[model samples]
Target: MTKPLPLALFGHPSMARRAWPLALIVALHIGFFLLLRDGLLNRIVPELPSTIVTAIIFPPAEPPARPVAASPAPKPPGPAVRTIIKPRPAVRRTPPVVMPPDAAPVSAAPAPSPIAELPPAAAPAPAVPPQPAARPVHRATVTSGVQYVRPPRPDYPAQSKRIGEEGRVVLRVLVNEKGEAERVEIQTSSGHARLDEAAREAVQHAQFRPHMEDGEPVTVFAIVPITFRLDQ
Candidate 1:
């Protein structure tokens, strides 16, 4: 007899109906996974230019330094040249003329007679007037002859008196040729400006006899001492 064909080749009728839904579910899952993978692959970014990126991020390198040339030293100066001067020849002097021994001596010529001289005319004497005698010059030291026509005494400063400021003020007075005090300078201070100024004013107002030199009035400087005593 011939071998029978297997019955498994022909599927069961009830199992076929249940297998259709499971197969459909598997196909739908495979299609959804393929769509997701394709979308992720499309979103991937390309690589950037490395050279442009590096230039923007980092600074450029500096160039190498160049070598410098040295300066040349100056040369020393040469020795100076010597010069020789020639001496000039000496000048000769001519000798004076000399007389010969054989020549005869010459005689001198005779002088002519002098004309007769007339008597000199007499000149009349000029009349002379008697000259007045010179006046004697008398010089006297000013120590005793000086007389004051106006004697001024400084008024005691009320402030100085109240303060009991007592001292001597020496002043230098310049008396002119007119016997008037022309200027007054303070020689020594009385420790008070007011007292010193008062003394100067008094001396300026006073009149004095000018010093006599050769009987002529002359300007002189005299020291006048003023005593400022509060008690007196």
Candidate 2:
């Protein structure tokens, strides 16, 4: 006896129903696609008109020709030429003949006098008396005496306590005829304010001998230097 197939293994009837609708739809779609493809091909391709079919006629090829001649070969170079020359020595020429001396000299005419020797120079006019030379004027040079301090001060700030510092300062002072200081300039700094100030003060107070030029007083510039050392 043949074994009957199990109901569970057999496909459902609903699947069969779905398969029929899908098959129908696919068939219809295929027919529609074929019609659309045919219509597109007909629209895009143009119909060719009737024309005479002529054989492709290539122009007759020209007969092979002979190559043109290359320009005539350049003429062979001319033979190298040789020239012959003879050398001759140079000859020097002598100058023409000249007349001998012994010829008489020619005399020139004398010139007439203009004023008979210029009137003897007029006796040079009486010699003028010589004037005395003016006295020489001399410019005065004022000189300043050297300052001598009884006690020497230290050169360092810590050593000179009284002046608060110690250093050397050079001052240029203009002394007038009256022996007074007209202007004072610090020529060199002492590196210490106190020391420089002291030097200036001393110079102002110092007396000067008026410079005399031609026995007259004149103003002049003088340079004064002051030193501050320890032990003052």
Candidate 3:
């Protein structure tokens, strides 16, 4: 019990060599204060120098533009689509038959002479001879007269005998079958057309003596009265 003083202080070799150099100087001062508290906790407060706090976040104010709703006025174009063209069927053009390049065959005009196509046998019915039953004959008169054979006497138009212009003209002559005076007619108008054209050129150069009738020289009509008198 009393032998436990460090085993009696190491059994006392001068107090065990001064207690082993004072326990190796308190264990080298507790290992140099635990390496200066792990070099002042590894001098780490300098980590506070990492506070570069540039926090300038200014971006949040854009929400005031909601007024865009006026787009609805385009609806008025609805009735124009008529494409109906159907009329193409009339092509009957057949007129091209002209084959005459001269092979010498155009001789068909000689058939018109078959004795002039023989239609002339119908001319034998022209023998009509029965027309003579109503007569009371015996008419020879120019007032029962006519006998001149060239009597032409009328020359008074020296401007109607110097304008005294007298009148009487009747005329109407016709007389032909070769007895002459063929047609002279003023049947009565002598208010003087130069004394009715000098009494129709003196009864057309007069020459009349032909009124025979059944013995044939008949063409008659003769009323003559010509007189333009300037005292002569």
> Which candidate, 1 or 2, has the higher TM-score?
1
lDDT of 2 by residue, 1-232 (tens): 3243344544876665656667677778887799777897566677788899889989999999999989988899999888867777777778875656876655787887676555555566788899999856544333455332232232334445754665678888877767777777888998877678777777876667776666877667777777876655
Candidate 1 residue 58 Cα shift, in angstroms, is 68
Q: Give the TM-score of candidate 1.
A: 0.38
For all candidates in order, the CA lDDT equals 0.76, 0.68, 0.76
Which candidate wins on TM-score?
1
Summarize candidate 1's per-residue lDDT along 132-226 as a digit string, tens digits. 99856443334333478787689998988888888899887778778788878898998899999989998888988777676878777777888
Worst 10 residues of 1 by lDDT: 137-146
Clashing pairs in 3: none
TM-score of each: 0.38, 0.32, 0.21
